[model samples]
Target: MRKIVYLLFLGIWAVIGPLHAQTVKSDSVFLKLQQAFMAKSVGLLEPVLSNDFSVGVYNSPIAKYMLQNIVSHFAVDSMKLKAVERVSGKNSVLFIVYPHGEPAITTRAWLNDSHKLLYVDLFDQLCGLNRYKVSTLQATIPIEVKDGSIYLIATINDSQKPLRFLFDTGADGMAMRKSLADSLGLRVAREQNTSVVGGNMQIQVSTGNTIHFDKFAVNNQSVAIFEHVREGTAGIIGINLAYQYIVKVDFDKMIMQLYSMGNYNEEDKGGTTLSIKNGKGILELPLNLKVGQKEVTGNFIFDTGAGYYVIGFGDFVKRNELLSSGFKPYFSSTTVSMGVSSPTFTGNFEKMTVGAIDLRNVPGTLKKYREGDERATIEDGSFGVKTISRFNFTINLAEKTIHLTPNQRFNTPIDFMLGDKMFSFNERGQLAVLVDITAEQLFKQGDVVLSINDIESETLKKDPARILKLQAMPSGSKLSFKVLRDGQVVTISA
Candidate 1:
């Protein structure tokens, strides 16, 4: 699908189309901007996007000096515009750029009615829009699924220690947990605090002169290190890896394949292709979901980093009357997200359907969009790994399709249980129990849970990621936990 609004992470420039030429030379502006990007020269880029500029999702504007300092470290090449169309008004133009083998990028430029250059919205690609060079022939790497998230186990920097990263499309480049970064004593390049649409958080961006993934034996990769991640996962490996290789994620056999660019073929694909559009880094898919008897179709963000199966928007669900009248609510601890922290909670979906595939009593979580936050309104919902892992799904960003085939795991039931009440993290960094637990309690409101099923509480304090692993067990599965109540260790079985 075509879009005009853009993200700041990707590069951007404005060249007015013939749609409106009341003021300036359109061709000259485009040629200059295009030449500047190919040369990787900030001096040329500065004058084009000079004066006031802002990041895509947030309103925070940075001066040209700061933007110049940031782009000075980039290595860019093979840049060319693929498509452009005037939108919003004659002044706003949306263009698609094809950077050699990299994912196709969408950018937007706003101009004055007279067609004078205003500014462009660019997404943050640290390498400054370079295509990753394909190196290997064909390699199929084994993948593991835990708590509904796919993990790619790899050895970094030739170290014998294995690194686990959540296979994520929601991230720009890649991220390393600060704990691992400090433990490995990685050299830091730069750190910056960023303001996103939802809330404010700190992003510690790091660069490596040469870091090797001994398995793939890759080097000179740029990685970002964040302050926090879900427990049991070190960090995230963003979808940018697709730029260098043809990535195949098989949910059927629980494996992932990375084939060298020239080694991949069209015969390897089958089933219905899921259409996706990337205005920024997030891949949005067309989801025609059936909630109870009502069917609603909307575009859902493809978030492999998230664990839920299908998170419906509260307004959408309520309008469709998905839940039975006054269905009892069960609170679930799921998000570590800077956004959607205050989402209104509701009950689960008894059944759902994706294409011809029917899912029974599927486990899910619904998010009530936060007020005044544009990020929450970006999409109608999010389809996470939990729902996707049951199908053999292959994502081809180059072709812009997510292929899906129902696997043997498709009909398998999802066994999920949260106690009568629930626990989640509030803004104060304290646990919020949604229901009254003191009356008929297994655990109290303020009790710090030491562990769930022997997993430590260190990471659970940030999000309930570690505790969610046990949700896939059979209905008869037993749940055991250890908690700290009033400075004493207490064991309980549920």
Candidate 2:
């Protein structure tokens, strides 16, 4: 009996020792992940971040730009990891984070056998939805529409022959390119006059119906088509389809899910709830401010499409007496393009306060306009992605709630011009790269630039056989240019 008891004790001790060691290792792994996230180490984070995450907040420029700003400015003031829940029989863990200066955010981290995080999902607590399962209409590749209310994208056409569309939720209705519509043999019924607020833009809407997608077919019942849209997009699915379902955009797996009415799950809601008012969506946040030593009430828009921070000139001027009292521009090297519809200013503020929070040396752009009127349309200075990206935020349309959570994982501000460049093609199929840099010695916008060493876009397109001969040029590579600036022909070297 004593020998049996001894054997049992030995067996229990052996199991418990290994279990305790595993627990320690798991804790260590979690800590390492937290450290990497806080450091904003992209290389170290690459091993842990899930590439298969999607954020389809009705494709509003606000949500897109806000999240983009967060990733770009990858730094946070404070991050508190409050708790972690590990599910049985799964390699995933749920984390609840509290940000000091911002709102709270919930995220999921999945580990591989090597104990490295293979996936991470940033959740919008208001919607309780992830990238993959935000909707019920499931397809590997889907299309999208950008109405102001919903960021709607869908998998159109047959499953065997699939077509994907991305709709801008900021837009009014479904739209597509003329060339694409012609290729599809779509017939236009009538043209209606339509106008957009920003940039003094206007378009002619054409209503038509055809077989949109094979699986998610849109005859006359499912869609209304418009042509010659804004924002240089191909086409849209629009509010017709979006209003009927809860939409989700899964960027990770490159898929879209649409949930029918009364079919949403209660797992984890994301985004802030919103309300539609007088043909516009209103997301009002309470704020306290002083106007001439008198407290005044003010409301701002949650505009994601506007990329930077903008403030009302009238309000600012009245409070600080800036217009009549001239001040020097903060930065000496500031320039702007002709068609970009941002405000103009010659002064900068050392600090600006939002509620009780004070932002130092906040780079604010001032615009000339009334409180809420732009080109005869209702206009309000919006809180753009620049300020919103400092924390994780969501708007719940269902609950009519707005939630703001500070994100601690980000602690680094990204240099935009140093990271990536934009590219497009002219009408002649010649690729035009809108180099996102202002190297006065090298290149400038509207320069009708010729070539960068051997990287002549026109030459490359004409000669397909010489594809392999092309290579990436160094950052500061020397190049010759034939520029057409202000109708004069000049030659320069850099």
Candidate 3:
């Protein structure tokens, strides 16, 4: 019995000894981090940081150089480390820091197997204070409505020239073209593989940046770099802005207002307020769609990045047999995203309902999935800006609610394929016919349009608003198109 007890004691010590040593090392690293902050020196952190060390809010990791830049701007004269606590899993440690005249900050750190600092998550520490926070109670920014989308002007870093950004509710964070990032000399913090509308692609990200617009500024911003974006725009201002502020868009006044969270009252807004589901930065709402006599209900993303009314995923459309259930499709085209294009069909739904609002003769697009393709499970479809812009809506992401009031364009008829054909810009900026299902086959794919409705193609290309106006013409409206096909100019009337 004595021998057995001695052996058990040795076994216990064997396990405890390494754990205790790890704890001591972790504590030492934590202390060093605190010291680095106090001294405002990045060199002190170098000894403890891992080769792949990154620091940022939860799930938003920036490179070490970004943290160094941020630290260089810190005024930590009145800051002190309050406590250090060891968390349960993955050699995690929490640091409680107290700054003079500010709220206490709690930072979480993860140590690697070699006891080097792997990642330090400052989400709890900076989420409410400096990162993406607006100093004023409210800010009013002018908005431009073009091609059924909203555009706002902003300046990146220290650039003085105003850059137009699309206010996209579908994007997870801010995204800009790689050329723009290169022009601004933004440093690449990391690379990540991300899934987009059509497919997946690897993206480059920059962190710890600032964005300024009008009278407001956002600090510690993270921007994803893309290969290209829409013409005449810088990039995208994503849903992160809505997460930080109460976004109210007034289409009639052509303005967007950003109200501090919890500062705007819904009752005063006087609109139909409805709850929304926020999952992984995507906001969704339940929608009921009617096709012929069948009714299908599903949750759809509230996406301002989509320029059309609605886009149904393959899973939902196939499950509900939307194509065969007395539904009429007028034209077929291709939808492109991130340089990947997929075939699509467009038509009108009988009716669609969202909360208390009802829309009749709603237009929707459905993707044509290839065989053996994986179906989406997260969302049924997405509601686009064309339908959403009809309402002057206020979205409060903190409260998970949206207040919507109908605007003047509420009763406007939904736009459809004007002449039983679809058009898109080709590589050389020429308007080419994309789809034509007319009985006469007046237009063929790749036909370069020379003129439409007496408007020159070059003039139409210069002013896209003219194309939209032409496309929005009511049903039974006639149009004439002149195109170059088979090396010959041909005029067709519909």
Tens digits of per-residue lDDT for model 1 on 156-179? 664677888788866656777887
Q: What TM-score, computed on C-alpha atoms, does each candidate reach?
A: 0.54, 0.40, 0.61
lDDT of 1 at 440: 53
Q: Which candidate would rank higher by lDDT, 2 or 3?
A: 3
Across residues 1-494, which tens digit of lDDT does each residue of candidate 2 receive? 99999999999999989756555545554565566556654444444333222233332323333334444454444444433434555455566555546676666665544445543455232333354444344333342312111123333332232334444333334666566665655556655444333333333344445434434555453233443433443455443444334544432222345554333453335433333221242343433233222333344444433334434434433444443444443322221111224344423444445544454434444454334334323334445444554434333333223344433312222111111333333323334344443455344555554443445646644553332232244566554546556678566665
Stretches of candidate 2 exceeding 4 Å from the true structure: 1-167, 199-202, 208-232, 235-242, 248-257, 263-266, 269-304, 309-365, 368-375, 382-396, 401-494
lDDT of candidate 3 over 45-117, digit per residue (tens): 8888875454331111234555676566654544344334455556677767665566766666778777888
Question: All candidates' lDDT scores?
Answer: 0.57, 0.42, 0.74
lDDT (Cα, 0-100) at 119 in candidate 2: 37
